[model samples]
Target: MTDGNPDSDGLVVAAFGNRGRLETAEGETLPYLLKGRRLKAVCGDRVQWKQPPQSHEALITDILSRENALQRFDPKGRVEIIAANLTQLMVVLAPTPEPDLFLADRFLCAATLMDCNPVVVCNKTDLQHNDALRAALDEYRQLGYVVVQTCAEPGGNVADLTSLLTGHTSMLVGQSGVGKSSLINALVGDAAAAVGALSDASAEGKHTTSATIMHRLADGTRLIDSPGVREFVPNISASSEVQLGFPEIVALADRCRFANCQHLREPDCAVKQATADGDLSPRRYASYKRMKNITASGSV
Candidate 1:
């Protein structure tokens, strides 16, 4: 176990802690213990630590500087940091529980707002055929976003995913049972995350990832596997911001009826005209409307 002192010189973080072996840097697992009240350290936080005179375990001292962090309302409605210094967000989804487009869009929108590159990953490709899924993925690719497909069972197509993640600090996020654990295991080259089965009756996943963890890959890549978010309610996006999330929507918003027209209910709304002309997907329009109303309600 570790003891935090003012003289320590290493970072403090726990991955799969069990009062015993915990994953650390360079594939080194160590023993750790929580310190004082103000010493709250989550995954991906850099800290200072030092080993005792006669002991093998090291004690953490101070947390170093963080580039940027992602905050969200916890279950108690209190703000909490999910991950720190994430350069990218990997939004994973599978077809078993069905791909929730709304969830994916919200995650992608948040990542864009935070200046983090968002990569869409669809796992469990071996279970289903790819005609419709490929079509959906094509739209994102056309938008200039990188999308990858993986199977994660024995041998899957994770090479594309790994290539994108190399040498960058990224966070893997999605709903449970989307093969997130499987993908993490593949990326890190081990069973770093625990895999759980989806509920047979409800087709929903049993949550396996209990906390956020930073895993370093062989190619010097760093990734944070956060707890699977079942429901992603994108916070802090205004009407204009929502439009900005959909690049195509913003591209055609200037020709709308009014400069301030939300493109929902306006006399000469260009967005509405385009939708009528079938230039935009009805489903995407519907998603925008939902976000617009949610923002207008003043409740993120």
Candidate 2:
């Protein structure tokens, strides 16, 4: 989106086909459009663009190769990139709407599959902690997941969570009403993000963030706030690759009798044996099997 250079570098801040916004090296944001069908730019993509000879909008010439990407499958069974080149993923949860431990596990598994650092953010510390919520959080902490307690209200603050995003390009993802937008506002010290509350009747979070957008902290850290979803399925390729996402399963996978064991119904499967021996969390194993089933029905 920059001037003069035929191939200028820019960071894709927001992309919505046909029109996208890019931030140039000098911190200037310019709107541009894709030049061809080769590059499907998404949030957090570093791209190259140039001004067309007789056009006002810059042309996106290229999308650089990404180190990693967080992706999901759409309803049509198409793989979609949610965000790219993220260093960390924060799974936000709250008590009012009741945290879904299975959903949390899915996000954690997605993080592992994407090779990104995962953090569990328990928001709304101001509210009375639900026993079930605390117990679930305890399970995450036991599995070596970094957990942070944060609140984005008057007495409830955001400093603890802000420190985690200091130097990394992080994505904040969770269901609505979990205070993800509120936490983003608090961490970035702004009120631009839309905030929504749970339905009084249903206690379910209202959809707030309609699009994926990026924000920057004062310390040069980039944060992306994504739309809340009721469900999330990573765009993983194979059932065997799913086991690699679970550390406990991977630790025992080599011990299985057969090298190509799926572990669900295979002989001498160490993964299933670990669950029976009480070495692995039954819930995590269950979540693993559920994902295996989900991915098995889709494309490999």
TM-score on alpha carbons, each prediction: 0.78, 0.89
How well does candidate 2 match the true structure in TM-score terms?
A: 0.89
Worst 10 residues of 2 by lDDT: 194-203
Q: Write down the lDDT of every candidate, Cα atoms only.
A: 0.69, 0.82
Candidate 2 residue lDDT tens string, 101-220: 777877888898898999999999989998889988998887788999999885677777877888999998998678877777777775253223211223354356777777777767
Clashing pairs in 1: 9-49, 9-50, 10-48, 10-49
Best by lDDT: 2
lDDT of 1 by residue, 207-227 (tens): 466667666777667777766
For residue 24, give model 2's deviation from the true position in Å: 1.0
